[model samples]
Target: MFHSIYIAGAEAHSGKSIIVLGMMEMLKAMTPKVGFFRPVVKQEDGSDPLIHLISNRYQLPFQADELYGCTLETTRKMIGEGKIDEWVKLILAKYRHIQEQCDIVVCAGTDFAGANTGLEVDLNARLANHFGCLYMPVIKGHDRSASDIADSVRMLEDHLATHQHCEILAAFINRVPNNQTDNLKALLEGSPFPFYILPERQALGRTTIGEIARELDLKTIYGTRQSLTHEVASYKVAAMQVQDFLEHLENCSLVITPGDRSDIILGCIAAESSDTYPRIAGIILSGDQEPAPQIQKLLKGVKPMRLPILHSPHDTFTTALKVNNVEGRILPSDERKIAVALGMMESYVDMQQLRGLIASDHAKRVTPLMFEYELIQRAKKQIKHIVLPEGEDERILRAAEILSLRQVVKLSILGEEEKVRSKASHLGLKLRDIQIINPRTSELRKEFAEVYTELRSHKCMTLKAACDIMTDVSYFGTMMVHLGYADGMVSGAINTTQHTIRPAFEIIKTKPNCNLVSSVFFMCLEDKVLVYGDCAVNPNPNAEQLADIAVTSSDTARMFGVEPRTALLSYSSGSSGKGTDVEKVREATKLSQSRRPELKIDGPIQYDAAVDPEVGRSKMPNSAVAGQATVLVFPDLNTGNNTYKAVQRSANAVAVGPVLQGLNKPVNDLSRGCTVADIVNTVVITAIQAQEVKA
Candidate 1:
């Protein structure tokens, strides 16, 4: 089943909350753990009444504060300051946390109550698209005609599909008049999308006296406060005489009159206690007037009837007009209305069709944000020790703090212990659970130096030279990984790539059946993660080396949960062009296919043809890996390096690695200008790689 569903609305008072409650009720019936999330709410501190109602009624595990992402003011400020991407990242992180705890989450969109509802709708669409959520738009039909409701539904679906690119599961037409239900359904029968129509019920729309009191700034004159939950089906201006007004009284009607109108007040209250009259919701004594003292004493005795009596400052006509336009809300104490809403939804909506739509779309592709989230989650499953050589660097220390706090990896930093601690303190970072080591003064230094000399004696390394080299943090950190003291090593934030990887090349060496060490960057584009190979290593390789890079890159992609569709990138598509580069790519493709026939690989394809489905079909129609290539093997280092950087800077993609492949033990490098996030991601990937090695 889907982990979540988004219920959105096209306009205000769309009755979207009914659908949310209905979906929650439906899911709760089937599963024990269901969650509710509201990404944007109107209240400043997120004290939203709907969130509270749902939480209290369902007894949800999460508190009301945890159910919403942020208030509208915060969202507006973030958008004004151009921090929308940061906002989205925060929302996704919060959503992933909830998803981890619940079997399913019902995410409701904004209420469309503010002046910027157009922007609100667009934001809702953007969130649904970003999260890969299934969205259902609720079209309001309160004052709209049947044909107008149909047009609204169609336009909303078009906007969601074409503009926002949202995967719409269905469309709900809410608050339609009972008489127009058949016509609305008939009008929408041929809709390409699924349509559900819920007829308008007065019980769901009736305002209460408490709501009126709050809106008009009224005072409680008499009776029980709990009786405010009673619904006002209709309102009447009691300007007429008692006999005539009694004839105008309807079931659960609120009477509006001056408090001095003793006859009307006494008659309504008496009728409320009589079997011959319909029950009155309440009486609103307008004009800020009070009854005579004798009548007040009479009301004190009648207070036992448990009826609500409110007093408003406005006149009777004005109070009646205000009551006429008051839109009801589902309050926490309004159980009767909620039950009616649930019954209406169960009666009108097709539960089986909705259940089918709720089934998880297994074919839905993963987004870059989701891929990053999964990487952290997977790394946290099995913690591995990763050594960082440049511990004194502020960026390294910051990254170590994050990794340490998240507990994604066990970190050991190689440097002067006090210097590392002082640097971290200066940076205001608390590096908890991170081990600090001084390579020269450490007990393991002697053992690592002796082992290094023995391993390099064939190249005429002396013990003094080996011990001196081991004092260098890079050599010491690599020796830690080589000797199985640490599972992996990440360096080069403050050193050259050669200084970082040279120790690994000499000591850890390549894995068996691997001829050379190649690197691939996990380029996280907007929609998916693509592996770009030999981007930071192997300056130029012949056909065999290129083939090895392709195969190794494919394996690396698979290890990270990405399906391998290898694309041997060149200037040509299939057999379209001839050049030295194209010939090498084609030969490499042949070699890789021969070695690993299980892999889906296509050769000599242009970048656009490899990534765009239409272009790929036009160029290479029958190739399996033409358009959906997840692993793109560049012909040389120059091309791969330039392409990955260009995409990273221009497209705003997150490049997560220069992750070295074909190594027995994991050792990854970073750019000199890498950020703290870069170091953290590299460390996480390295930990995951170590897990694979151990397995």
Candidate 2:
């Protein structure tokens, strides 16, 4: 078991940063203070983006000079001068400086990108032994066979661990094909330490707009600091006329045209505005020229454009080549890609269990960060089709880009295709392969209207009226959920909650087993995540209805890894007070346990007694759910809603839902004031729920 780890690659381009970044993410969740260091970086002056990415993303308080001992160039020169001992001392001092301030520090070995492989390997082995840290060797599995990998691992163990006295933590084999994992595992069956196999992730190699700008030193003209995170899928030189250029547009394409070509510039904007063409990642104005004054004025006169407009001094050809060759990695500015990289670590490694082996003192609880990271990975494994009704809004479009980029779920946006496309273009959004539909003019409208009429015919509904109502985006999106068109629907960004869920109630309805629908907010606090129940749906549930809420909320808690030690919350602690509310909670607790015999519940519990260990023990010593309550069930909406909001604001917690439960199919409503991040999370949860429905 080791708190700190040193990662060394078997060869150049082993892509060991994936393991480094992944380890840092896991350490951040498991421990309070985590630090990162690089023994020998490529750049001696500490201008490495990986260093900055870790410092900024994790909010480390280390300066650039404090991050690394020396550059690879410096190491080579020092070794030639017979100063290897001095170099070791320098690196050990720097590593200790960081280790002193952190609970654990993750250090990266020399970038084998272009270093002297044998010398760097020796240095890493020596440093690991000196630091008394765990040595983690990463191998590239792209073209290597089972026997090849096994031989390499055996050699490393024999050299580093056997001769150099370095503690071998684990071996990582990255970029392997799915079919090769088993053969590789079989070949290395007798390894001393566990060997982890990670498949190749294509997105890990793709560069973003910010990386291109930094690599080429392009001057930004239009995009904000945030839009710079857009990933460039492809690039093209727009040397043709406006009509021809419009005809040749591509999805997420970076357009490189002459700066003075006002016709092409306006044509690109027009393409974005019409939704008839592909989405543009950004535009590059080349040849050392600027847009004409009139064209610039026209650009300002138009509605705010998000398609990043940049200027490059080089000619179109040079700029295009530079853009294409820009290397991609997880940048501090791009949290979405960081999520993707972290997802790799989460899916392949049993990080929680691994922590027990490495850090025995680590608290056996799920942090909010770990929960959110695991949530995204879960949704990606069972990709479900989800529909968004408020497709024209900027927040919705922005979230759509992230969802599409991550490939977490299949998405359909309900709106006129042209309008949604125009919105997407204006936002510089790269919504690849997302289905767009116009509810009013869709081929399924008649079918949806007929289904609606038959379902509501008992209420004296007419076909014409049903057709008119079907034109509403909310109703259309919900109908998609009812039919096999979409697995789930998320809305209420611009609409009221009633407008968003009325159609679900009228059409999809509740499940056959569950008579009531309830809601729970996964309140992500500072350290742990807790589930708050009946916060958005039920107003004043009776004992039976409240009992149902407790049962469903417990399942929801367990679904998200919050083990349910349910507390039926009221104003009093178990049998200590007399009130109708307390009585109702006590009755509900009994009713819940009777319905689900395996439930752990105690009712008439005060909030403090239910959460504080000392208070819970003092007040309800014999009760099972006195403390350690992961799920809190509120007796009424007024209490549940107010308490959740108070904790969210006062304690700085992230309230993830009001996630709807008890539906035959999954249909979730969003708060009207939700942000782009909220929309993204809600959609992810809805997709997971849709998978549950199928199950």
Candidate 3:
């Protein structure tokens, strides 16, 4: 199976040819047979230099016509004012040949050969459809106007959507100006595609051992970083015969020899003194075979030469090509992108976030409705009654007993005293330092009546009704938060989001100036976290509502140690296309910026523009929020829900929320799909939020 991917520019001058060659040189370590297939080459005057490089340098077997493949010009002419059937067949044939032998194929495209309507074959679309290869569009990193770039991306997207049947796995923005990249990045963030912004670096595919050593803090006994230059060449093969190998070693940084072939190793050293190439960095021996003793000793001594040897089990041709695929290699640029991705993922998630994500499904990771109860839990810098709704349940009783021992919280249970004790005893559930209340017989304290009467009048409720509602756990929970009876309240195991919040809202309400309540779902992945908002409320919010959502989400993000870079997502970017959805995102962005002038915000961006630098550059070059958007605010619930799910299923992103927000107190809902860990995490998050509120 192909282990890596490589994409070249659309035009010959688009820099596809050199990049392919450069990738081949650097991917020398992964495998020897880097598959070479030009899906569409227009030149009729020349034999493909790439084919010769692949066959001769890597010693890859090739039938003459197979190596040359189909020249796209004849096909383009034949299809355009002519028949396309034969051309399609010819294209498919070449694809099979390239796909068969190589572990990775550097797919090349015709500059603009198929762009005309007379021949309706777009080079990018045809290549993507016929070969089923990952699409990696390469663009020039020149000082091109943003309008031109945006137009180009639109054309590409339109072509791909119509004819291509593959993902734009990644993109490469090459030759970008140094000082202008930041400005370019801002523009890219508002696009609707996925891409990487590759800065000018030493070598494309091949990385210096020194750079890796420095990054990993590895002890490098061989190869000095200072002595190294930026250019690294790629070869398709380790050696042809022992004879052709020596001449090929000229000017090569490393002689990538096959592990099982001692002849190639012997040949490389013999040619070392030839002053043709730079000193070999070392040998990246292909395959898992052990080198002969004499050859190993010879390699060890080459006088003052620290010939570092690396190994991979694949054939020399395959390993060599992979070593040169810059796209797969983690460069410094990629590290930054990955780091940002990790940070976004981290900030987007929390315990409540996780609960909201997993709460909706029935495939449980653990028991349903699991909860934590404490006897003397701390609240508001003082110990107060912490109610256990399921007072007679053994789990609650046992939790109460342990919490009491620890003086964690003042425990209050609602049940007949005899029943509570009997259940605890029968289940061996300890209950110590606990207080019990019975609705039928418990005396109403003076303060309870006074506070209840005051709240009753405030809410326009009858005194009797108010007192009765006050005894209900949900109602009492809200009162606990409001009346300082308890620092916080937690009770939603058997309730819905509304049930959990209604009592709280009715009694506590929100503090002054808090307009609309919102929710944030923190999607946590193994390596990162993500914050999704309004997933559980305001199903189809207007632009104004969305703006509010963005503000609340940003605040929530900051509360969780994340620096928010918000992306307002929509199907269209800017005012280029018309849609209520796009308008919502655009307005939300405008409102958010106006509301919080200091925030780093951008919007009317697609998901790709929000995260992929290359996509952002191509589609929205003037955006400050593109490519690097850490927080994504969807246009509406449908968009948010579907997009989040698609990303979760397709990109392996873990969706973790609908963490309820905008409540007077920290009361979140549990998805019926929650796991025990999800429950635990939510409780912890709620506790943290509650603690902050109390402070």
Candidate 4:
């Protein structure tokens, strides 16, 4: 229910700013009134282009000094005075002010050590309590080891856990090598927190073939695939006084030889005779010697393989070392990995790619709401009053302006009014349909005092303090929906699921008879939208919990136009194994059937049998859910996360979510690593949920 969100990082230069800006850009497309903020600023040169660009492009408003939680002087004195809470209070006041102005607020954070060191726990607690902001830790995209990233995430999570009392939305691993993607995904699969695998920016891949050749000091004799990158492995030399040639040609991709050495002719013949390895680039003959007839014949035969032989004329030692150094040298005509990553990202992380990457089998189904949309089209009811939370940047603000102008949704951004307008202006964005609201101003009304008091009665603080806390967008969001102001609320851009939902629970409450809130992700592909549930919320749900999860997921599937044939998955199948794991799935299946007798549910089934028709037939004859289980329910979080990732990376399936379920109203959170398409899908899902709630 949070109307304003704050995007924070573990440290500065951790790409926190970029992530916040990107998310803002995506959110703005759907709703207007999106605002940006930097509640606390420490280092103020006032001329940093990045800050300037953010200020102008996002139309954000912040005195550089107010952006940081504590001043250097405040920090310097806190060490001597031990009064961190005082500084935190100052920070909370500013955040509350920002929250009161806009429908959505994007609050950027200071560094890890400096801000936290001043009042450490007290400051964070105040920030989290006051704003109910979801703290997402962003890691730098360096060549750090996997363990290093994990340790860093662990440290951030531990720190935030102590102060925020919320979930780590997701850990973003940025700028990773393409080859190392699978390894990193696997490594983080078992992590306690969500891990988003982001590729290194492609802007770094601008190297051309000529550049690479020059760097390697090699002549590009023949090849227009001049763009073909040479990731050279260890170069090997087969110096046979002619006899040792056989062993030398053993493991080399490129061969280096003395041009005058006619003794190796026999070795060349032997190498040509073996079909073991394919010939790649041709040989480099040093010392510039013309080959003898026998050598010439051998070279001609090898030339048919299309290997380009080059005459380096350099000494044997120099040539050997020279070829060995070409592994990652960027060619002049060729693009570097960085550039390729960028090019790929331009297309790869786009809506289509994101949809494709996370697409599942159920994505093909259409929701029942298509009729509702048609009805709305017929009725011509204007769609308005769209609300978004805080922590938005320039890009998002521009999108919000567009959506507003296009009349897509009534845009509402949560943050400070002046700051929101200022950021929009800086971005050259015109938020025509957007309206700004500070949650603090509206949430402190006398009507909400009773509910606010009841919700925060047990926690630390008095009625006034609790009232201030309720003014936070998190609590205000619930009030907005309760009071029937905005048609729907979209949050979790910068907040955790809990932070996003806490206010909803305290005020809006759940639909009658609904218990055990769950989650589902709509994994969209090119033309499909698969439903994955309970992958996000439940950790180790037992039979009852599993049954509840299955039923809810099935309903979600049906809502999306998918026929809900539920598959309760496990490691073993058809009673092949005996353990609590298998028993739990079985019991859940029975419970699901009893609870919803009409649901086509199957359990204790292998993934293959659940998804593959052939496997389903072979394993269980005449099974109803065999090979057509559109909704898959895993035994535990570990299994669900690992399997989803493996399928996404290895089988090339697109996985959209951990879309949250079981809320009184529509509210979902985003992974720090989510693409724009993911945001779009989550938004659509939220829209649908909102429709249902309204009905």
The TM-scores of all predictions, comma-separated, are 0.53, 0.81, 0.42, 0.45
lDDT of 2 at 78: 84
List candidate 3 segments past 4 Å from native. 1-453, 456-459, 641-657
| Index of the highest-TM-score prediction | 2
Candidate 1 lDDT over residue span 1-695, tens digit each: 56478888888888898898888777664455678888877775545767877888777788666788887788878988999899888787777777788867888998876787677778888888776678888888887789988887777777777888888888888899777888888888888768888888776777877777765668988855557777888888889899999998998888889989999988987888766887788899988798889988888876355668898888887887888877787776654566567656766777657777786533244555456656765787788999999987878887787676555789999888878886664333557789999998999978998999999999999888988998999999999999889999999999999999999999999988889899999988756789999999899999999999999999999999889999999999998889788999999999999999999988989999899999999999999988889999999999999999999999998899999999899999999999977898899899999999954
Candidate 2 similarity to native, TM-score: 0.81
* Preferred candidate (TM-score higher): 1 or 4: 1
Error of 2 at 133 (Å): 4.3
Tens-digit per-residue lDDT, 358-475, candidate 2: 6858655566666766787779778999999988788898888788766788999988887788666665565778999998889999999999999999999999999999999998
TM-score, cand. 1 vs. native: 0.53
**Candidate 3 per-residue lDDT over residues 1-695, each given as its tens digit:** 34334365643334444444444433332334556666555554434444544445444566535654466667656667566657767776876776777655666665454446312325455555656666666777656655555456566666666665546655556555566567666767766555445444323334544333333233333333322222235443665787666556534355566677888766555554434434454565666565788776776676544344555566667666665643313232222222222222222223233223222432211111111111001221344455544464444554455445334456667667888876654332346667777644546433454576776685676676666665666666566566665555555555566776777676667645567777777664333455777777667888887888888888777765456888888887666868766776777888889998888888888888877899988888988778877678877787777777776778675454556666666665655555434443454455545665643
Q: Model 3 scores what on Cα lDDT?
A: 0.56
Model 3 worst lDDT window (10 residues): 367-376
- For model 3, what is the alpha-carbon lDDT of residue 130? 59
Candidate 1 residue spans exceeding 4 A from truth: 1-359
Q: Per-residue error at 527 for model 3, in Å?
A: 1.4
